[model samples]
Target: MICLYIGTNTGSCGLITAQKDPVPLKSVEVELEVRDHVATVVSTLNYENKEDKPLEAVFVLPLPGDAAVCHFSAQIGQTQIVAEVKEKQKAREEYDDALSSGQQVCLLTESDESPDIFSLCVGSLPPGESASIRLEYVTELAVQADDGLRFCLPAVLNPRYQPQGSAGAGFQVTSVPASLEPYSLSFSARVSSPRPVSKVESNCSLDPLQYLNTDQTQATVKLAAGHKFDRDVELLIYYKDAHQPTAVVEAGQASAEPGSLMGDPVVMVSLYPEFPQSVMSSTASCGEFVFLMDRSGSMGFRIKRRSLQTCIHSAKDTLLLLLKSLPMGCYFNIYSFGSRYEHIFPKSVEYSRQTMEEALKKVKKMKADLGETEILEPLKHIYSQPCILNQPRQLFVLTRGWVKNDKEVIDLVKKNSSSHRCFSFGTGENTSYIFINKISKEGGGHAQFITATDKIQPKVMQSLQFALQPSVIDISVTWDLPKEVSVTVLTPPITSILQGQRSLIYAQLTGQSSEAAEGCVTLKYSLAGHPSENQLHFSLRPAEDTGLTVHMLAARTLIRSLEMEARDNKGERDEEMKKVVEELSIQSGVSSAFTAFIAVSKSSGEAIQGPLIPPPSDFWHISAALLGQAQNYHDIHVCNFLITATESELSVKDPLLQLVSLLEASGCWLLKPALASVLGKTSKEVANLKPASASSEVWATILALIWLHGFKMDAKDEWELLAMKAASWLRAHNATCVTECVEAGNALLGCRVTKDALGL
Candidate 1:
């Protein structure tokens, strides 16, 4: 059974749950500085004490999976104190000791629950005083298919389901509705790259892009205020001459010695290795493909909308496309799960016309009706089935991507890696990225996230291409440097090397080397039976005044590698493990599970002991519930004398009214055939009306344009539906010639309906 303390105040949400704390966390602010391929974020959180006594405040939040927390500090009035990195236990003891002695202090530490989640505690704050905390971290961007580097600022942590008797799985938070969030976020990014920047894109609207230089290599953008924070803030940057592998050596901190983890020069090698044309051309496409689809309650909630198509519709369409494009000879099956699961075929079937048609028919009718997100049962069922002879097995998991038992599922996928290659596709905004990524990485497959802002088809097909392509094995990375200059590899061994994918290697360079010397790094892998290698040569000369980015990131990688080992060690806290983790954490000043950032505040007043403000969940509920119900704060009403409401008064030309009628009558976004009926026409006639353009006067033409903008941001009714009518409608009515009128209507109505938006 799962337990949650749902309260309305800043009580114990995590650590110090029953502490006599009085302060409640108030607001948070973040600033991002993007340079080249890495981003450094500084997050600030404010806590206020309104009670009559001293208090301790604790709040748990998530960091990006790849973020390396480097610096932490706290401020009250003009007194600003920086934190010292120390062993986790020692730091915790000191924090408690200081609080008990009536000293003001603050601490930040990562949770033992999950590596990406962390907790911040502000202890012993006097009445009416406010404390401000600032945390700084750096992370590298993930490159996308469009050659755009993507960055995401997280919003909420989707609660994961832990099985009975699972280890250390308490307090996993369930996701809250975005509208109920009682916080505000203001984000700004400054980007500087070597190559000329093309433009930046985001799901949330942004201020007009500003270029700092004539060459356009540096620019800045801010999230337009009043934008919703319900979803992760994602920024995609396009630059000229992208996809080229390169190396970077960052200089160390000035105060530290010249030959240490934090002070020594470090290098980051990006490898965009490409398989030989012969190898790619010789891909073994035959396989037994198994698709696991999530049919959970949260899956029913649509996170994105585009041209009347929902996340589920897009996911199903992607699956259908994959099914149709599979080679002539293959076996396939689909296992869908929620609280329960069922498979269409008792065993995998050959991918022929009859079977494919049967699967497609079933897929079209698939709904998100299962009660809860439980996928382990179906996964086990699929893994239990016997594999077919000669044909390799490929597992394609399609889901909302936010399942609870992710670690368990990931371990299972890893355990059954030999039986199949697992390709994971995440649809909808805020998909559980860590879950999808871990499964693919461990299962020797590729992962893709399809969001409302992305063009769903091409990326989905690209993942299919990877699935069809043969996997690369026996991967190794070798470094060539001077005799005295040794290297310490910070990341784990490269296991999965897919065609058109990228990888990175981080290392700390030790010993002395001439500035004229250079280093060469090469990656060797085997595709099918053929062996290949890719190499890069980088300079040894260190750049001047480089921040602690490279060192911090390298330490992060090393910490993760160590944590993985510790995890498999069954929570053993042996002396050797503790010593290594402590040394690394102290040396790099990077916070980890075994280390924390602690600061002390100098004060001259006596601390009051009043009624214990038990840190329960009650303090947090008020603001969330307040904002959630703020929806009806100022509802507009027309007096009877002013006007009377009637369905007959609704105009066909009213876009909103038309959309409502069409959606409600169909009960959902209807597909092409269903859309034909909605518009009182036969499928054949609807197909013939495809040439309607922006300027076309045809009835179908106007309907098609309206259809594209049907997925408005504030689409009144929460109901969503799917239809492909516009693509045919536009094509049949010569959309190119009708552009003028479409553009005019769009400008007048303030809506968007482009080719990409319609998936045409």
Candidate 2:
């Protein structure tokens, strides 16, 4: 267990009692079972008290933001106690009473400031006693850019940087390095999908995949020998038919009363909307683009274990891609923040040669020198500016996600969501998923995470493409069911819909229907003034093997919406919403911010003596260098910076990015040495080869398009939208001699590119 100290005057001091021997936590064993997009995880944590007196252990850990924790229990010797969910205050009172009476008790509750953080307390643990804790949760895997399902098991919980005047103002964290941690983790996963399972990939070492069925739909994998719990464990699962829409209906709990959230069958529907090609071919020409970068000292850490690049450096590269991808005639600005924030321009400026170059120069010199993570202030500054007329506003936030005021940040974005859209990027293993996910959801935009093994350019460019697409409006979902049956939608209203993005909807089927009854759901929306709809039909029969996972997830969805509604209301309405939330949380046996899980062992009645003190772990900011480990960290930082600096000096060693950089704000490449060099030709040679009827700029633009198609065909996902923008600019100019330019360019670049391929 980890001990934390808060408030000022602490001075980075250790516990007066000295650190205990043989740290209470010993090892953890986890098993994961995944069916389709849903995953169920069971974890067992073993602890031993080696001290002379009674010990109370407190462990704080991070979970996925959208996970639903369903079960918690502890075993002490031969006795086992299962916890039950109750109102937070009532559970706390019972725990305190049990501890005072000398009974063994345990309490688990979600943090008020961050839903992803959970704190567990074990009281009155006898000396030399060992306890095994079992926790179970279910979560839906996130869809990645490549259509893979992403599941992350968080193992790192860095200290959150709190603002000076905020609640818990002086909170300081002392942490034991992963190498010094006294616990071991054993992990394994079992996966089954409706479609054939193609493969599974992870950043950590793993044994060979073992197939459980000849159809290749069931498989299992486990961590390799001598695995360390140093960073987050992430798995990306791929299926052959990934884009197919599907639905699962789960039967409710039998013991629960009818008409309750847990008693009714729940159905989860997954949809992937496809837009028309004509609408998708045109990119928006104008928008106010704002980029917010995190420059805190923590950003200096490696993006992932054994990676020779820091979070700040990767972010800089992504920013360069984003800046170069902006459409002509757009407005833009750049903001970087730490304890204090600074902007490249006092106000947003129109996109042009001068403005883009100016922003890139400042971004090139930026580093992670700032002391702390303070994001709230700069966000406010960005929101305060008056938006340009006829230009939509789009905000891009890049951070490592280590701020205390996450709830406040999310609320602020929710309040101002009507004015603009937000695109968020989280850049590390320990990135706060809740903060990153919530901020983007509230602002009606998309969220992406970049880990050690994940590439930053493709993901960021995908989100930029979403931003440049025309916004969808008038979204609605309609259901067609038997007359005797009805549906109660549990999920919140759909806000922003992007083409090829996944959306999940949960609903309760209350009435009875025939065994072979079929239901249909249609999603309707407008894109670029064109009406569109997608329909999915499914059988109403409950799935055979799904146990209350769907119902529990549905309950979680309603509970979250109610919690947000409570915060948005006042007086009687707020209290009323909270009451509903608490009742539903207890009824569904799911953990929430307003409720907690508590258990007491009635067999033990001996009150522990003396004041229970938890052993402290070494914790200090990485910038402080208070411990001998600083030298190792410093060495890693220097090595990463040197390698990244060399790569940057070579212009990313990526000709695609270099070609993108040379394109003008008007989406045309000028006939110059830089442009010719990207095409592997001399400036004089490119000029002499230009068609007689085509201008120099026209020839350069055609060559650029041909090169992108000829050499970078494998990376069409990253450059497709930008290429569309360039094509739109050419068509708008009514450029002549298109066939001549294509022929000359293809021959000069040694390619057979046609005019039709350039969208001319």
Candidate 3:
């Protein structure tokens, strides 16, 4: 789909396939500025035409799914042309007309099939001439499981797999390997937060963090000496108090007419709800848990360039932890998909000793042998199943998220959202964040990502806790503004509220108000029949030097809502909604699926007159092969190179996971050899250390709890609930020598945990 056209010296203009020999794009430079949870990114792309004649290059790149592209411009010599947003069809026509008349022009538009993919066309470049294109966009950073705000700049656009007979299936692209890529990248970031900045980490090499202020609230970091476009550029920013609620009121743009989305003031409110301890202490005992796993070839690919561990390996480990942590009396099932789908159970099965063992046995054998990524069919199957009475449905989807049918998949989830909650996990460096985020957002659940540098256990366990929490009801938001002022909410209604989860609300203030006035917004919800409220009172005066990031993000939110409505509406309504979306996109100068940014240069000296250049003889052959195979650039097989563990790796196990694996379905551990092995002792030694009056299962459970509290305290977020389950089981058994067992267990495991700490 991405091609470049270079005219011949003989004045022949023709469509030519992209050849790696002399690509026009030379280098890319990016600057990221983060304020609290929002980020603004500016990128400069340098291009040079080395051919004898004029060149036209088309490149398709990836962006964050939720990014609001706000600026586009091109600099040629002394003149700079700023692009304007227009209806997509009209913009394309204008770009073509300019090209025909030999005036240099450029066009940028979102992909029709996916929001994350964008195409840029630069035409009629003069021979040996250079151009610098500047692009700017704004996006909200995602909060991670470890309280780090995540910002990802996709450096690689992996080929999306289009299923047979799907839309855009024939649009094949030629991708040069990372090693052969003819471009360089440089990235820098500046971060500021209301709370003091704690630290910043990345998977790639980076310069040391430099604090800019006394309070450590502002800092800057950049990529180290040499950088390549081989993988995504990711940053994880930690703050001293990440869970605090905050609000930003940004003044509207001054140049635009009043009453428009861009011209009016906008406020972004961020809330991290904290549930009461009384409600949190009791976990749900009944639910239908369905886990959908992606087994496509891409799953065999490593999560990081330097790591030998593949995505499937980490995913399997996460699944093991999840299965072991489920509460009793719950119903569960597992589904794996590639080109085809398979389920371990014909239907949801109740949680019991036999069922748990059976599922774990089957899970250990799962492999990434499937052909391609096709998730829609399995989702449909899961939705069609009958919901159990009094037991809620909680779906967990794990995948690389590499598919072209993003809209279809998201629409399906939206339609069936009321029946269940969907928690999505994107597990590789090159995941389709748009796909992962949309499904979860629409299904009234949360989305999590697991990269090579991230620990998957904590993230998955957090989602499981969300699944077990009682559903929040009676959700409402109230705004208190000046009598002369009013508001219009741009974000969708709040439906799902979880403990320690950040929820964002964007609203537009249209009416005039005093500069010194203040406004208050309150969020109310009920958990387990208990009412709760959180309110934020912010100044009516707008914040300075915001660069309209909040307004653009708000406009993007409204446009996405309208676009989804257009898809769901009938012919006339759909047309009406499309018009509204296009008008708003153009008014706000934000790029959307229905609109594009176009700029034309009138200073090109002469018209380019040439016949079309013909592509090389091998172009057709290569295109055909890539199209037939779906061209999944990340689809690799896990072979000898990916397995770095020694043959005896199984013998030296993760003591925590080993101890967890020894727990029974009843949440008690038997005094077995595996338990002794996990405790770093022989079975005879452990048996001799047990209290004389304590039962075998009770002693084994106490030892496991002591070891977790003493050694694995760092991973408490992952094992805390399981330990609770074990404690509850021990209390129900009512074994004798309760204090003696605690003392003896601590002595045997070299732990100093008190009986009270275990909630005995």
Candidate 4:
């Protein structure tokens, strides 16, 4: 007989066997197993008594309701039997309750060919022995917004005895909309075993600038993935007028693809405006005139021994033209100066052919005396005369060079702007023409350098025209704009336009206009009759919708205009040029890469070859020719040549030397540097033929020797030879210091000895 002991408890349940009872005793054990999506258990039993006795037992375990029907198998003797049954109805009830409360479901595949379903299983073991069983089934899943519908795949624990445990199965249900067309987007979904999946839809819109100006503008829109997107977009453009329909033009576009590392997209729009062609003309008139000429000792120096005949001829010709063109009511006087001022034309004369002819004859007979050029005394003398101030007057000054008192003359001119316009004519190589030009600008007038005797007539006419043109005598603007609002005029005043010429005023405005009710600008001017004024109204809103983009476009435009104007020689000011150069320099912190200097060449129709090297002989001759044509030969032509020849290797001899001689005879010291640079490197033979110490040539040679010593070149023997020659020449003249010459010679000898020791 066999006896079995059974114990049932909530936490622990088992069967025990009792021994020595004349009956077979048996014990059974059960174990449960659980995985990612399924759970299962197995049972075994053992017999402890020798006498075999029949054993009976019952097994129970929790089951998942969604699981498929449970299958049971038993191995007894050599026979095997399998039974299948549905899971406990109570498990289903529990699952239904949990699902109703928003719990998720897990489903498994019954087999490779089956869909996902619920599954469960149970089995028994023979007495006093161990056996394996198989349970194959599927699981059911629940669906929710967050919890997508899915199934678990069935897996096998023991292939030979227990062929199936649970099959792997998964399905994805998208909670996001399939296509978000209204929002311009699309959606998709996917699943990797054991989890639910979902996705949101998105897309780019075709018409980007839906709200843009329809008549004159169009745009396109694009979409990207990041929180911040950066891309270059294109814009289609059109033009519209109040009376006409819009005309479309295809504009270019840029693209920013997905996953691009660069951030943010930029949109660029271009617009065109219709502008009328500009035509310009000018006329100049003089009511009263004063001619101030420099008659310093230097002027006595002759060009080709003709006493600046070319210059005098040009001046006479210019004066003749002015006198002939002067209205019959006009009057003029002539004043010449050197160490002191003198009245060349003793009294002012009314314009007449006879008067003019006599004045021309008088000018021809005039000669410059050798005296220091002091410009102040003559200018003061004219300024002190109250009779000239009763009516509008003009001052015409001619000079071969600048005096230290130039600033004083400029100041006086500035003070006299109410009654006078001061025009300056720079004549020769030694003259500070640049300074003269600056002074003229400051004095509300113009400056012209006479490059040749021939240029004098045209230049005078131009200067006169500039002086006579009626311009904006004064400009004033009044606006009722919000406090702190800023306004700037974009166009400069046109001073050379005719008194009645129509002109336009353009300005840019910034800041809010709401604070003030209205805004207006007042422009005051002087015309032929009398003073006049004009008014302009300001817009209530800002001129530009996008400040940054407009500013960038403006800057680019300005830069291009500036570069173009810098290369143009027609004497026109391009408002955009300086602003562009300055802005670029400020932003990039770089010095200007190139400096512009006017270079006219013989090859006028073709580009000049080589870098802009200093002017050669051809340049000097051409420049001289231009000057002569202007009738400013004695003064302006020589000045232009000196400035052009400075630091040039070609300036070392011949024409340059001759030019320097002319300048020195005019008492011009400005050309000393160029002469020094040339003579410093010339051979001893060349140095010996140079003028003696008492001559200005000697001063140039001394300065040259000083420069050579300062440079300290490697050719010691060559420098010594030049130095010995200079010393000998200096000793031949009582004008030079022997001690200084000896010191310089000793220094050269020492350098030669040092170089010889170094085998150089």
lDDT of 2 by residue, 1-760 (tens): 2244321233232211225343578899999999999999999999887777666766666787788999999998777999999988888888877877888899888877667777778887787889999999999888877778888888755567778898665553434334456789999999999888999999899999999999999999999999888778899999998989898988778898767778878899999999999998767879999999999877877777676677887788788889888987899999999989999999999999889998998998899877688999999999999989989999999998888888788889988998999999998767877788888888989889898534666788889988998888999999999998789999999998987888899999887888899999999999999999999999999999888999888988888888888877751338777889899999999888789999999976567665543211111221133332322222222322223433454335667878877877677888989888888899898988898888777888889999998888888887776787778778988887888888888888899877888788
lDDT by residue (tens digit), candidate 3, 447-560:
999886347778988999999998888999999999988899999899889889899999999989998999999999999999999888999998887878899999999998
Cα lDDT, model 3, residue 391: 88
Tell me the spans in candidate 4 whose CA falls farther than 4 Å from its real position: 1-286, 297-310, 388-390, 428-431, 467-472, 477-485, 488-524, 530-760
As for TM-score, the candidate ahead, 1 or 4, is 1
lDDT of each: 0.67, 0.81, 0.81, 0.35
TM-score of each: 0.77, 0.90, 0.93, 0.31
Which regions of candidate 2 deviate over 4 angstroms?
5-22, 174-177, 571-573, 612-651, 670-699, 729-752
The residue-by-residue lDDT of candidate 4 on 227-307, one tens digit each, is 111111111122122111111111111242221111111112111111111211223333677777766644543211212
Descending-lDDT candidate ranking: 3, 2, 1, 4
Runs off by more than 4 Å, candidate 1 = 1-26, 168-172, 175-183, 253-259, 305-311, 403-405, 570-575, 604-760
Per-residue CA lDDT of candidate 1, range 180-261, in tens? 4445677888988888889999988999999999999999999997876767888999889887888888766668777777
Residue 382's lDDT within candidate 3 is: 97
- Of candidates 4 and 2, the better by lDDT: 2
